[model samples]
Target: MTRHLIYLSIMAAFTACGDGGKAPVQQDTVIAATGGPDTLNRMVLIPGGSFSMGADDSTGMPDEYPKHTVRVDSFWMDEHEVTNREFAAFVAATGYVTTAEKPISKEELMASLPPGSPEPDSSMLAAGALVFTPPHHRVPLNDVSQWWSFIAGASWRHPEGPGSDIKGREDHPVTQVSYLDAQAYAQWAGKRLPTEAEWEYAARGGLSNQLYPWGSEALTTGVAKANTWNGHFPYDTTTTDGFTATAPVKSYRPNGYQLYDMAGNVWEWVSDLYDVNYYAQVGNGTANPAGPAKGYDPEDPGQQKHVIRGGSYMCSDEYCRGYRVSARMKTTPESGLANLGFRCVRSVANHGQ
Candidate 1:
């Protein structure tokens, strides 16, 4: 298979459906105890308001352009990204298996590849996910493959491949989870992923037309603002934020809505099908736009992608400035990287308490 097909096949493996019966543990109780406050208490109510969405500065990518006015209805959102403890509780209560834990099927691999592409070796089709392996020396940022490796047996439980474990990092944001996995947890918790607009609105934290969730302050100024790479990209890291990877939730102050880690820690998965040109198509003063019906990425056109926001510990000014509030990134729904995770939101009308 071609290089693109190889990438697609590996990503497709991450989209496999999970299977297991619900366990005896009460879902509500389990969710309640998984870090933060109990059920409704943990969710902060964001006041409904209007804000300009997308990048308003020169740092924005093409997809973050055509800044438009968006109004979102008030909703309750988690105080922070879902943690390992919370995810573990969800798994314990539901016996759910994440996509990364599932073995790849040849049929699934073939579906993403070209019609007559040769089949990959079975040895390459193991249960695993991508891990960010920083190089000892700086490398070109253009080639992402230089730092990402598909390691077998890598999952949320083992974030850095086989030997790694969550262990004492229960409070840290759960990573290596696919969109489906996140959606599953949201559903079981009687919540749902935030729309791209709702996420940006909540991220903005009542701030209007600002660069970051905390306003237009430079990330490098003052104390460490978020868990981002403090040195050269893909190599040196000063750990100026006191973390080389995902940090424990609430390591820093929260945004205006009292939400933590909205700018960094891990890239948050939003409930929006990614379209490179979606912003151009959006009408001004759109109310609660849910995103396009289909997903498209010119780089990987055949692969359906979803929008991920907030950036991550790996984000740096030299490379990805994803920590910016209006910044946007896309990844295949099935693909889960070490820096990706999610949180949930609940609507006022459907507040299942």
Candidate 2:
């Protein structure tokens, strides 16, 4: 599609032109030109108001239960996710390497993957954060063992880890970044990560109770409306999403919010702590809802785990269903994975002055 067309889609849902009577960005090239380093110059303007935050259906977790009402303030969120070129600017400014890229100590590696859990022995063999490995190529796709591994010189610059360069992949989202890493980029960009409520509501794109961001339609239609898994699933994708791995940002159509890739492609990190029982706290509260102030999850085995929503490209109807807008999961704030990335948000009051 033409750059002009892309901008038209982006401006539809969000607007983030920055303080003062700034004009809305209505073109792709114009948006790219304004995004100085790690951010998109343009944002989707989410009109704030009250709405139900969780799903009554059992497809979601309990924390998303009770289907209580809450309010959200107007905010400006990135029209597309953060890409390699954008993240590269942050690394250059900070000399930062993702935790997965950094060599793991013998003790740390052993704790997660014991001698018998199919985990490769020797931190020397290299074990970085593993994400999705497509079922195609006659390889085990769902099992993360195939792709994610700690290889020396594997960082954002080397996305596939070692032997890889950002060259042509500059348009793809940067992977293996931790929550802290995402926050750092947000800070540098003069923005913040969207809270879980805002993230889901925005992902819904104004759909009252739709499954995915673009209504009930699934990403897999054998034609690809959004990037997602296809074929035999954890065994084979058939490249139905147009590409096995991630495609360039905005490769698909935008939602009502003029936002792209909100439901699939990669899991975007949010600022809210993961609380399975959070909605119960809403209890007819004001609109512009925020997630639980505190977070805890059995999966993390630590204190205060954070929430991550919007499933990854690895999502499958049989194995994974996180592509749904209300779908959510929890993980450590320090964890990083190649299949996971993030977007940015700012208050609407701060936008266009």
Which candidate's TM-score is highest? 1
Per-structure clash totals for the candidates:
0, 25
lDDT of 1 by residue, 28-137 (tens): 22223454224422888998888889897877899998999888899989999988888887787677777787777877776766577666667547888888888999
Top candidate, metric lDDT? 1
Error of 1 at 60 (Å): 0.9
lDDT of each: 0.82, 0.65
Task: Estimate the overall C-alpha local distance difference test score of candidate 1.
Answer: 0.82
For model 1, how many clashes?
0
Candidate 1 has which clashing residue pairs, if any? Answer: none
Q: What local lDDT score does residue 165 receive in model 2, on the 0 to 100 scale?
A: 64
TM-scores, all models, native as reference: 0.91, 0.79
Worst 10 residues of 2 by lDDT: 12-21
